[model samples]
Target: MILLCPPGVYKAQSDTHLLAGRVAQLAHGRHVLDLGTGTGALALTGARAGAQSVTAVDLSRRCVATTRLNFLLHRRPVRVHRGDLYEPVRGRRFGLIVANPPYVPSETSVLPRHTRGRSWDAGPTGRAILDRICDGAPEHLEDDGTLLLVHSAVCGPERTLERLAAAGLSAEVVDRARIPFGPVMRSRAQLLERSGLIEPGEHLEELVVVEARRG
Candidate 1:
């Protein structure tokens, strides 16, 4: 199987861990979109999994260029575009849209540093990005298409499901795993107080995969 390690020149965290293979499992002969496609890991993985077409979007020009390089290096046919969220592909629908958006509560928090405003920060409660994604995802997804997202389980999967429900979508936790806490863990802990993120004395968590679909 072809693999993409990581890209150089961006301290931006990956959209998803083990993203390359993770996406391949869900993508098959479908048009796929990888939001915040750093290093094109997920996008390339989807392509190798036989996606009909794969498009990667990032706000960073460097990420866009890096994704193109990685795509060419892997001989994967993926279109890399520099844009925020769904701007580049506005009005276009996909069978699958995958994102590992910045779920950390604060952009200024010490974790992995990338160019400013890269969509990694999730605001004070870390739900900022999640909110937008939940609200806007339905518009971009086909009736039966799926939106796959990775975030901290600490972000309250129940809250996320509620937000999606409010947006006229149905969401469920498809996969979840634990990883080490980076510097941002501190702030998330504090914000949890306000958002009821998780409970105290609960084990700290790293990532969660939420797969939702529009009705």
Candidate 2:
């Protein structure tokens, strides 16, 4: 599908494709939600996979515009909203929710306010947005619904599993891939090593897809 990613909008990358592949497997005829839907990559993937309906949420206006443009260009109908995480979809639920959130560990405790960094920096420990997604997803999911999330192992996949389980969902690491560190991770490799989040001289991080189901 044709997508126009203007300045400040995140371009689809490996993590996006990883989540898109999983979404394609399960989105057929299901109501699918795409959180942090940058470039509308995963949302378009779901629509192409025969999802009955697709709704996408993003905090960036540029991203929202870019996704809407992609949906129109591809002749795929997707409800696009601009808001933080689930804010735009309050009181709604879906059969499938997919996310490829910002997971690159950052030095600051507070997430970036306004910069390209917002696309990848997730504050110290890299759980700023991931934690929110895990905590709130159960409430937004229909019974027997599934949540598919992709992130770097540097953010602690085990913690995500525990949080999802604690939220009353059965969660597991469904997929994993080792990829070389991108610009963001490479820039902070030293800090990550000092924090013991990664081994010294490590140039790669494991990307994991955590699948959580609400029974």
Candidate 3:
């Protein structure tokens, strides 16, 4: 319904909606956890799909507020928490977990702390947040639960599958979308090419949704 994204808050984009679609499909009867719930799109989708409960976590206060505001606007309920990934929901397991974290490959490996870059400036390999999510997801997912992660292919979706598999989860790419580079990707195109993450003159990136299941 109404999605108000202030200056610093992330606007719900294609990736967010893509994951939300899957959230709507799998969230029924589940306790859902949405990591990086920027605008609460996915969390709200989970609730709309009849989730038992929905909890959204974000490190940015602005994102947390925006997510809550969106929930209020739509009359949906959610537990919005302001904390880094998995920190606020420590030891709490969810029947379904969804994430659309930053997966843009940046110049350095260091993640942003307070700046707007924290929204999309993922580390050089773009696994800064992705890896952490993979490593921590197992403990936070109930048996038979599923984790849905959407990220750019340039950051290596296969690596995500590998990491999750190493963690004893059955993982696979469930969906993919190829779109022309957005502003951020256009700006970092040259760097990505130089770093061998993409081909020279490549103006498109494939966004993939990887689903990992705990059994």
Candidate 4:
């Protein structure tokens, strides 16, 4: 689908497409929530796939506006909100929750405010956002619902599984894709190598989709 992404809104990328396939398969007949909605691509996919309802949340005002506009342009039904992870939807639950949150390890913990880096920078261990999702997603899922998260293996998918499991959900790697470094990873290759996050000169990183549900 063609989306209007403003200057600061994240453009849908590999992770988005990866999670989208799962959305198409699992979103029908469910009330779906797309966290870190970016261009609302995943939420739109859910709506298109016949979801009972679709709500999207993003931390960026630009992203919220872009997504809302995109949905309007497509004449699809969606509720778009601007807020941090799970904040806007407090006390709400859904049948499916999907996120492709920021997971690229960055040098600092302070997230970028004015750049596109906000879309992927997740601080030193890249768990800043991932951990939050792991902790909060389970609480927001219906008893039979599922949470789907896509991120780089560099961020430690095993840890995600452990966290989700500890939170009372059964979690596992559902999908993986090894793609050449994008501009962000390419720029941080040397740093990642020095930090032992990746093998020296490793040009490809594996992306993983983690699926979680009530244990």
Candidate 5:
């Protein structure tokens, strides 16, 4: 599929492909929602996987437009919305929801505004958007629905599992990959280590795909 990622919109990366692989497994004939659908990678993946319907949501106008364009370019039918997580899909429910949110830990508690950094910087604990997704997903999911989320271990995968469990969904880490630090992570290695989020001299980060299912 031809995808055009304009400036300020996130280009699909390893984490995106990881989540897309998982989405391909469960999207057949199911209604799928791709939260934080940067570049519409996962959404298109779901559509191609035979999903009954696919809806994508992103907060960035650029991302929303890019996703729509990609869907059109590929001739995939996806409903694209521009809003915060779960906000655009209010009163709706889906059988599967996938998210590759901004999980990189930042030094400040305030999330970035007016910068491309908004695509990767979560707050100080890196739970700003992660926590919101974990909390809000259950309500948007049908009984027996599944939520696929990919994030860095530095943001605490256990916390994600626990939060989803607390919200009445059974959660587990289904897949993980150790990847070398990228520019964003490489630059913040020291700060992450100082914050005890990562071990000193640890240059590798584990990206995990957490699967949460509603009973």
Candidate 6:
């Protein structure tokens, strides 16, 4: 089974990705949940950081298999589930919910060149997944639990903060970085045009890490 499994079926070792190594440092010693846990990057990092338990979920079966393999490889106690955001984790709450969902503004193509799945697409406005995650997060987090997300600056941290407020969460900035533009930006622009999210010709110049906590 191991030999026949596709490359996508096993979690990969990536060093330069945004969330891989940074998660442990940020999520230290928390009861964490990793939404969209592709390749188990954040999940593994949480385990390494001394989380009580790491519950990671992904919509892709392949991603679930890969995450399972990664957990075993590290001998960490992680629960890998296959389902969309919050579905697999219904009735459960965490002290820290971390997600690196596809944040490319809608109309742009996700990276990796070959990905053509929900894991890579963020809908027409690129806020589809992020919106849903934020809307549902309050119910899945403890009063002091935090929701950590990495997304594009194009998506407008201001808008994200509004969404969090609508859901009764207080939003804050934890980190920021500038990534070179990609096809995702084109998609984001197109989505903004169609959805009236922004005037035509506006540009997004950076990415941001947003942290929100339930009241």
Q: Which ten contiguous residues of candidate 3 have the minimum total lDDT?
A: 1-10
Stretches of model 1 off by over 4 angstroms after superposition? 1-15, 18-22, 107-119, 186-203
Give the alpha carbon lDDT tens digit for every residue of 50-167 in model 3. 9999999999998999998999998987899999999999989999999999889898988887888899988899899999999999999998899999999998888999999999
TM-score of 2: 0.98
What residue pairs clash in candidate 4, if any at all? none
**Taking the tens digit of each residue's C-alpha lDDT, what string does model 1 give over 1-215?**
33344444334343355444467787897899988787777787788889989989987777788788888888778888887779999999888888877776663444343654444566666776677778878888877888888888766788988998898888887777676566556645665655566676454575667878877
lDDT by residue for model 6 (83-185), tens: 8889998999998898888765544444332354455466555787888998999999987888888877656788889999999999987777765445545
Better model by lDDT: candidate 3 vs candidate 6: 3
What does candidate 5's lDDT look like per residue over 1-215, in tens digits? 56898889888888998888899999999999999898999999999999999999998888989999999899989899999889988999999999999999998878876689999999888999999999998889988899999999999999999999999999999999999999999999888988999998998889999999985
Per-candidate local distance difference test:
0.73, 0.92, 0.91, 0.93, 0.92, 0.73
Please state the error at residue 97 of candidate 2 in Å: 0.4
lDDT comparison, 1 vs 2, better candidate: 2
For residue 159, model 5's alpha carbon misses the true position, in angstroms, by 0.7
**Which 10-residue window of candidate 4 scores lowest in summed lDDT?**
111-120
Better of 1 and 3 by TM-score: 3
lDDT of 2 by residue, 1-215 (tens): 56788889889988987777899999998999999998999999999999999999999888989999999999989999999999999999999999999998888978875789899999889999999999999889999799999999999999999999999999999899999998888999999998899999999889999999985
- What TM-score would you give candidate 1 relative to the actual structure? 0.82
Instruction: Give the Å shift of residue 162 in candidate 4.
Output: 0.3
lDDT of 4 by residue, 1-215 (tens): 89898788888998899989998999999999999998899999999999999999998888988898999999998998888989999999999999999999999999886688988899999989999998998779999999999999999999999999999999999899999999999999988998899999899989999999997
Worst 10 residues of 2 by lDDT: 105-114
